[model samples]
Target: MLRTLSIRDVVLIDRLDLTFGIGLGVFTGETGAGKSILLDSLGLALGARAEARLVRGGAAQAVVSAEFDLPQEHSVLDMLAEHGIAVGRDEPLVLRRVLAGDGRSRGYINDQAVSVSLLRRIGDELVEIHGQFDNQRLLNTSVHRVLLDAYGGHGDLLAAVGAAHRDWRAAVDARKRAVDALEEARRDEEFLRHALGELDDIAPEPGEESELSRQRQGMMNGEKLLEAMNQAAKDLGQGRGVERMLRDAVRALEPMVEKTEGALKAVLEPLELAQENISEALLQLERASQRVDLDPNHLEQLEERLFALRALARKHNVTVDDLAVLRETIAARLAEVDDGDAGVRKLTHAQAAARKAYEDAAAALSAARVAAADTLSHAVMAELAPLRLGAARFSVIVAGGGDADAWGEGGWDRIAFEVATNPGAPPGPLGKIASGGELSRFMLALKVVLSKADPVPTLIFDEVDSGIGGAAAAAVGQRLARMADEVQVLVVTHSPQVAARGENHWRVSKSAAPEGVRTRVEELSRADRQEEIARMLAGERVTDEARAAADSLLQGTES
Candidate 1:
């Protein structure tokens, strides 16, 4: 519910502040007294398009702010929270907009700066303005289905349809992915099998290349190594030449030892030690030469193994170390190819089940909508007679069963509020068939019937009593009052009956000021309200009989 509106430098409304309360409030003024300016200010605060002309002449900017009190569970609270704008449960939601003289604008919510689009979205949720020229919400066929569902209280059914739609879409995506994988694997089937065959044939092992290279290096120099060992052995008396000479010298020294006494004893000991060392050296050389391998056939075999491993590595574009891993990967791809058909078939079955679920949920929602449409049409028709629309016909057309392209999360139903202005006339869209006055009355009747279901907390009707008077105008006022029991209602009316029906009344008038003409609104007292209504009934002059009639209308509403 809107609690207050503040306007600054907005056209004729130079600086105006007004407070509002629950139930019906009426703004009554003579022609050109700036009632429209009041609404424009409210619109500006509600994120309407900012125009340079809307800014008062010679003023730098125009500002308007609207404050509202919303329920704790209102969807707008969640929306604000999503945008990082926190609103406490008891805190009022304030939306303000400033329009510069150059047509630039800024919007704020709860004193926090926000984009105009966001402000507009929240404004849409909080207030609905219905006039002869501003019936977009009821006229737009796109929102008709949503309005019908809301009226029918189909929250659970809508949720079910949404969930089913999501599940069906997910299943479709999964099946498409599986089918794509199967097709790709089939295209590469022959290549995979052939590559696996080559890798299996070679059967390369990890580190085999390095081990083979090491053995090949040793074998490549085998002949040179053996020749050097043989030469060293020959130099160290391999044929027993040094050992034989040493033993012969030792024997001669031993025989002369007795004759030479002590001198011969020292020489004999040294000759025996030299002969022992030469014998051990000859044994070591013979053992070393025995282990040297000089066979060319073994070296050729080693080279063949090493080269084959390297050639296979280069052919696969992988090192010898990665050949084993590559073989495993190839085997896995081949396995997938062999099982691709079964995987795709399983996914296809799941997709079918998901589609069935979605169809069932959508069908149920559609059926419920058809039933609710009849009830809503009847309810709205019942309201038409009291508002001087007895000859008119109101209906809710729930159309379904289009092609798959027309299906949506909200089900397949196409709902519209259609009306026929005269008896036997073919019903057409609400906006196209009704005149200015008829459209406003039609909206009022709909609002009266759907008051409890409408989520908007406030409803503003401009020129709702455009052409109706006497009993018809009083009927319009009574219905507006009835709707106010559920939501806040504000009407800009010239009808005395409507003005007298308001729980609160304000008189809008234009006055000449020092600078220029300015528009002002005064909240009328009980006595003041009677005068305003009389002024509405008698025009420029308020007659005694008009005052008496206005008093009676006020009393009738009170009763």
Candidate 2:
């Protein structure tokens, strides 16, 4: 609900502050008494396009501010949260806009500066301003489906449909990916087969390559190594070698021991130890020579296997040890190719299941909407005739079947509001067939029917009672009052009946200032309200008859 509106230097509404309440608040004045300045200033504050001409002549800028009392769960708070704007529930939301004299505009939400577009989006959630040719979301045919769904309490069903649609799309995407992979594998089938065949023929083992390399290095120089070992063994042996010479020395030392005491004995012992060490060295050389196999055929076989492993490694761009692992990977991919059709079939089944889920949810929502259309149409029609549109017929048209391609989160429904303003005229779209006054009244009726479902906290009608009077004006006033019971309502009206319906009444009047003309609005007391309504009825004069009529209208509002 709008708490207050402050206007400064906006056309003739300089320094005007107005407070609004829960019920109907009306602003009434004569034909050129600056009645529209109220709405224009409010519009500027609500993120409407700025006009430089709105600035007062001597002022550099114009400012309009509106304060609204928002509930904790209001969607406006959610929208602000999305934009990272924090608000305390105890504080009212304030929207302020400034129109500079040079035509640049600035916007603020609770003193936090925001872009014009963002301000407009937030404003859209806070208030809805309806004029005769209003192109607001309510009148747009595209949003009618949402309005109908909200009114019918189909939120859960709509959510289900949206989730199911996402699942279906995901299933389809998964199937497409599987099919593409299978096709790619088939294209490379021959190459994989040949590579696997080559690996199988050679039968490469994990550590076999390193072992072969070692064997090859040994065999390549086996003959020369064995010859050197044989010579060493012969020289170290006992008979005609170093061991025999040590033995002869030991015998000579033993004879000397008899003559020269301990010195000769020590020399003989060292010579004996030398002979034993030489024999052990000869034994080791013999064992090594026995282990060397100097066959040419063996050498050739080792070289051949080593070269094959190296070649395969080069071809696959891998080390020799990695070839075995690569072979396993290729084999797995070949097996997958063999199973491709089955995988595709599985995914196709999943896709079908998901589509069924979506269809079920969408069908339920569609049926509910079909029922809601009739009910909503009737409710709106009940309001039309009283607002001077008795000849107008309202309808809710739901179009679309369960076509997969045209599916949306709102289900497969295209809803539109159509009307016929003349008795026998064919009904067309609400915006197309209705004249300015007819459209406004139609919107008013629709609003009255959908007020509970609408999230907008404030509804402003800019002379919606444009071309109608008498009972029609009173009916418009009555509906506005009814709507205000659910939400705040502000109307700029000229009709005395509408003026009398205001829970809070304010009068707009213009006077010549020293510099120029200025507009002012005053909250009317009971006596002042009577005189104003009398002026509305009697033109330039308020006679006893006009006063009596105004009193009657005010008394009717009380009853």
Candidate 3:
């Protein structure tokens, strides 16, 4: 439901604010009293195309905003959620639109910026406005099935159909992903075959690069370490070396100090230990020198292995280990294309299965819609009589053979609402066949039917009661009131009878403003409401009889 509308510097409206309430609320005014201006302001705020002309002459920008009280199940919630906009539970959604003199426009929802297209999409679910020559979603042939299902209470079936459609599409997408991948593989088949064969020939191992590098370095450095270790071993272990000289010296000193003291014994013990340690170290040095095989052939072999890994790395643009995986991948690609017919057959079978599933679900949904159409058409026809189109014939024509691709909300039926003013004439498109007033009545009749099914909490009719008065006007008013019971209804009307039928009324008037002209709206009290109706009845003047007639109209419930 639209809770409030605030306008600033938009066309003739300068700082106008309206707070709407439940039941039927009517806006009444004379010609050029800015009734149309109010609706235009609402439309602009609801994401209609922005126009520089709409900006007030002296103003740099115009702002129009509408706030709506939406429920959980309302379609607007999902749309807003899809855009990542937060809509608190039971919180009002404020949509603000601003247009600058330069023709730039901006929109916001709950203070969060939103694209105009997104705002427009969310707006469609929030409000359905029917005005002079303006047909809302009801005129769209696509939604006709959903309408029928609503009337037939086929919500469960519709959900199932939607789920099936999504699953089928998913399967098709999976198959396509593989096929696209396979096609890309096929493009590189020849090059990959050779590359895989090359890696197969070498078959380099992980860490082989660093391992071979260490071996090569060891072989290259063998010459420098070989001579040094051999010389040290010769000096330490050969005759006249440290071990033989130290042992002889200890023997000589020990004998000379044999009678002197135990100090001579300590020196002898240290010399003996040092000689033994040098002999053992000399043997280890000789062993290490022997391990350094200066065989140049081994060095060449290590160099060859290191260069092989590097060459392969450069050629494939990958490290040596990655070559293994690369070999496997290319081989798999070659295998896939090699088994070409097999893959194609698999994809073909999958597509066939998915298509069959989609077709079955679509067929079921289509049948349900056909059944729903019959029930909905009957329900809508019943609503039309009370709306004063009793003699006029109406039909919800569902043209069969709608493409399965086009099957969505209504299972692909080319639906059109047709009407005939009299029983004998053939029914044509409702919008073209009915007069402006008749179109409004037809829209009202459809809305009254749809309100019972759709989750939208408010319905606004901009001059829906136009070109209608007298008995027909009363009927329009009553229908609006009846529809209001299901959801709030705000009507901009000229009919006094329609004004009398409202549970609440707002009188719109234009006043001279500092800028130029401005439109203002206010709720009407009981006595003042009657006087406003009298003015509408008498036009520019209020008399005793007109006042009495307005009173009678107001109290028409007594009759």
Candidate 4:
């Protein structure tokens, strides 16, 4: 519900503040007294188009602010959440707009800057303004289906349709992904097979490269060892053998030892020790030469295997350690290619099943909507006669049988509320068929029928009682009062009967200010309300009979 509206420098409303309440509230004044100015200000705050002329002459800017109290489950809260705006549980939704004299404008929600389009979107969900010239909310074809569903109480069916649509879309996506994968794999099938064959032939094992290298080094060292042993043997065998030379020296030393006593004996002992050590060294060298491996063929085989592994690793752009894992990966790709057809077939079947489910759900919803549309059309017709539109015909058209492209979560029916003002005329869109006054009444009739189902918290009807009087005016007032029981209602009315029906009343009057003409609104007291209604009934002059009639109307409403 709207809590308050504040206007500054907007048209004739130089400065004004109004507080609104529950049930029906009426604004009554003579023509050109600025009742429209109040609505214009409200519209600006509700994100209506901004124009330079709307700003008061000589004013730098025009400002309008509207504050509303919403229920916890209001859809506006969800929209705000989606936009990353946080609102406290009890925080009121405040919308404000500023129009500069140059035609530039800015919009704000809860004091945070926002785009005008976004503000308008949020406004559409909160308040709906219905006037002869305004084609909003109910007149919009896009909301017709939603309104119908709400009226029909089709929450469960709508949920089913939504779920089925999501499932079908998911299945479709899964099938497309599988098909894409299969195509890509087919393009690379030849390369994958060839690489797998090479990997199988070579059969490179983890750590095999290091093992081969170790073995190759050992073989090369053995060859060098054999060469060194042969060189040592040649040196020893040159001239006399080392053992024979040592024996001759020792014999010669033994004879001299007898003559030279102990000194000669020391020399002979050392020569004897050297002769024995030389004989042992020759024997050990021969044994070591036999132990050394001189197989050049084995070394070459190790080099070839190691080099093959290294070259293959380079070709695949992987380290030698990863060659075994690469082989497994390639083999997996080949397996997928072989099984691709089966995968695609399975997904295609799933998609078909999902599509069937969605179609069934949508068909059921369409059936429900068709039945509800007939019932609703009759109900609206029942209301038309009371509002002086007896010859006019109203209808709820639920067009179905559209193609898949026309299907949506809301089901596959196109809903529209159409009307024909004359008996022989063909029915057309609500906005195009009805005149300004007739359109307002048509909307009122629709609102009365769908009052409980309408989600907007506030409804404003501008001159809804236009072109009617007596019983018809009374009927319009009673319906507005009835609708107000379900939602807040404000009416700009010239009918005394409608004004008398208001639980709250305000009188708008234009006055000559120092700067020029200015409009002001005054909330009426019980006595003041009767006087205002009398003024409405008497026009420029109030009469004793008009006051008496006004008092009786108030008493009738109270009763």
Candidate 5:
């Protein structure tokens, strides 16, 4: 629902702010009283393109803000969230639009700046407006089937069909991709044979790259280790300096054993044993470092071996360990190419099944639409009679195509709404056949019937009743009142009867400012509304008769 609209320096609306309620709101005024200025300003707020001419003469820019109470699941709220605009669930979405005299425009949602296109997208979701000389949506044949379904309250079933259709299409697309891949692989059968043969010949293994490099290093340094080993051997057992020293010590200890007795003998024997053990360890270390190979040919071979592995790894753009995985994948692809027909057959079968499921769902929805169209046509016709279109013939036509092009949600056939103004004449398209007044009446009937199902939060009708009055006008007013129970309805009307039906009423008038003009709006009290209605009924005069008629009009509905 539109909670409020504020305008600043927009055409004749220098500054205006108005709060709204759930039920019907009527804006009434005489010619040149700026009723249309109000609508135009409101339109600018609802994402209409900016016009420099609409800017007040003294003002460099114009600004309009529309605040809407959004439902939890509204698509606009999702869009806002996606754009990083924070709006609480069930919170009012305060959309603001500003227009500069240079023709630049800006928009905002919940105080966060937004692009104009986004505002247009979000605005479209929140409000639906119909007007004279404008292309009203209800008259569009393309959407007639969906509208009929909505009128019949089949939104859930349509939603189910939509989900099923999307899933089916996705499956079909996946199968197509699989089949395409299989076909492409068949063209590479010979290449696969060659590549796999090469990989199989090489038989690369994980960890082989690091092992080869280490082996090459060890072989190159073999001579250096051998030279160091021989020198250490001469110092130990081969030279025998430590061994000679230990022999002298042992002889000295033997003499002490008799002189100092067993205590001195134990200490001397331990020192002699320690020297002998150290000499033996040095001999083992020297022997272990002996030159195993110092051949230049062996080192050359190791260098070549490491280079071969590195070259192959570079050619494959992979570390040697990843070659195995690459080879496996190639083998798989080659196998798939060899069994191309088998894979294609599987994919084709799956695609056929998915397409069949979507078709079946679409066919059922089409049947349901056919049934719903008949009932909807009858209901709308019933509504038309009270609006003085008793002679009009309304139609809901379902076009050709029994099953071939069946689709999701929207069903299998092309659908349209047709009408004939006079009995005996052939029924024609609604927009072409109906006059402005007839269009308004038709739209009003459609809205009343459709509002309960796929309802918009706010509805604005701009002088839709321009050519209707009397009992027909009364019917239009009554239906508008009834629709208010479902959604907020704002009517820019001239009919006294229509004015009387609104739970909330406002009078739109103009005031001249220093630079240009300004629009003013005020909610009317009971007495003021009575006078306004009477004034509307009688131009330039509110006689006793007009007052009495206005009283009767207001009294009859009591809305």
Candidate 6:
């Protein structure tokens, strides 16, 4: 509900602040008294388009702010939370907009800067303005189904239908994927078999490629390595080699040690150690030469195996290390191809089951909608006679035949509200058949009937009561008063009968000031309200008769 609206430098509204409460509020004034200006200012605060022309003539900019008391579980608070804006239930949600004369504008929600689009989206949930020219959401055919379901209390059934639709779509997708896979497998059957055979023939093993390459390299350099090993062994083991000389020196030192005793004993020990190291070196060289592979045939064989492994890897478009894994995957796919028909059959059965579920849910939803249409049509018709639409008949049309192409989550039915203004006339769309005044009354009837289901916190009616008076006007006022019990109601009206029903009243008027023109609104006291209603009834001159009539209307409203 709108708690307050503040405006600054917006056209003739130099500065204005008005507080509202939880009931029907009416704003009334003479023609050209700036009632429209008041609504326009409220619109600006509700994220309507801002224009440089809206700024006061000499002012540089204009600003408008609207404060709303958001309930704890209201959708507006959910939207705010989604945007990371924390709005406590105890705090009023303030939306502020600034329009500069240079055609620039900025929007703020709870003091956090936001895009105008976001502000507009949030505003849509906070308030709704219904007038002849403004957008009338009730006229939209798309909302007709939602309104019907809401009235019918079919939320659970609708959810079930939606869930079933999703399940059906998922089943269809799974079947399609299975069919595509089968087709692809059939197309590549020969290639897959041939690749599998090739991999099986080669019988590649993990780590085999690196081991073969290393052995092949060793064999390729075998001759040079063998020659160097032989040379080393021959040099170390020959008769004139260091080992023979060391043994001869050891024998001579043994004789000298016998003559010199202890001094020659240390020299003989060093000679004996050198001879032992030479003998061990010869043994090592002999073992090393035995291990070398010098045969050219062995090298050729290793090269052939290594090259075959590499060529097979290239043919399959995989590295040698991946060849084994690819073989397993190919085998698995072939098995799937053999089982393809069974898989397809399973998926087909699942899809059919899903379709059946959806049809059952949709049929239930359609039946509920049909039942709701009858109840809603009767309710709306009941309101028409009181609003001076006695001859008119309201109808809720259900276009449901379960055609596949027209199926939707809401149901197979396309619901719309239609009207026939006279007897035996074929009912048509509400927008096409009814004049502006009639449409307003029709919408009013629907609103009064659906007040308990409406989620919007505030509703503004702009001159919707334009062409009715006396009992009809009073009926409209009475309906508006009843709607106020569920949601905030604001009406811009000229009828004294309607104005007299206001729980709170404000009179808008314009006057010439020294600077320029200015529009102002004053909340009326009980006596002032009586005079205002009298002025509305008597026009420029309020006679005693008009005052008495206003008094009677007020009494009727109070009672």
Point to the candidate with the largest lDDT. Answer: 4
**Per-residue C-alpha lDDT of model 4 across residues 372-409, encoded as one tens digit per residue:** 99999999999999899999999999999778977888
Could you tell me the C-alpha RMSD of candidate 2 in Å? Answer: 5.9
Which pairs of residues clash in candidate 1, taking residues 3 or more apart in a chain or in different chains? none
Model 2 steric clash pairs = none
lDDT of each: 0.89, 0.88, 0.80, 0.91, 0.80, 0.89
Off by over 4 Å in 6: 81-84, 235-288, 401-406
Query: Candidate 1 lDDT, tens digit per residue, 1-559?
Result: 9999999999988889999999999998889999999888898888887789999998999999999999769999999999999988789999999999999999999999999999889998998898778745778898788789999989999999999988988999998988887777779889878888888987878988889887788777777877887887778765657788888788777877777766788777877888887778778767867876677888888787778777877988999889889899878877777887888888899999998998999999999999999999999999999889999999999988788777878887889899999999999999999998999999999999889887889999998999889999989999999999999999999998888889999999999999999998999999999888888888888899989988998899999
lDDT of 2 at 128: 89
What TM-score would every model get versus the actual structure?
A: 0.83, 0.82, 0.82, 0.84, 0.85, 0.89
Weakest 10 consecutive residues, lDDT, candidate 4?
Answer: 253-262
Candidate 4 — what's its lDDT?
0.91
Cα-based RMSD of the predictions, in order? Answer: 7.5, 5.9, 4.2, 7.6, 3.8, 3.7
Report the C-alpha lDDT of model 6 over 1-559, residue by residue, as the tens digit: 9999999999898999999999999999988988888777778877888778889899999999999998669888888888999987599899999999997999999899998988988988888888876667789898888889989999999999999998998999999999998888888989999999988998889999999999988888888898998888877767788988998888777777767857988778878887898788788888988999888888888888889989999988899989999999888888779998999999999999998999999989999999999999999999999899999999999988656867767768989999999989999998999888898899999999988777778999887788899889989999999999999999999998889889999999998999888898999999999999999999888999999999999998898
Off by over 4 Å in 5: 89-91, 139-146, 220-228, 238-308, 338-340, 398-415, 422-429, 510-519
Q: What TM-score, to 2 decimals, does candidate 2 have? A: 0.82
Task: Quote the lDDT for 198 in model 2.
Answer: 92
lDDT value for candidate 3?
Answer: 0.80
* Model 5 alpha-carbon miss at residue 454, Å: 2.8
Better of 2 and 5 by lDDT: 2
- By summed lDDT, which 10 consecutive residues of candidate 5 come out lowest? 400-409
Encode model 2's per-residue lDDT on 1-559: one tens digit a residue. Answer: 8899999998876698888888999988878899777877888888888999999888989999999889679888878899889889798889999999999999999999998888888788888888876686676777798789989999999999999999999999999999988888899999999999998888788988889988888888799899898777765663767877888888777777878867677677777887888878877787888889788998888898899989998999988898899899889878879998999999999999999998899989999999999999999999988887887799999886855698977799989999888888898888788888888888899999999988888898888888889999999999999999999888888889889999999988999888788998899999999999999999987799999999999999999
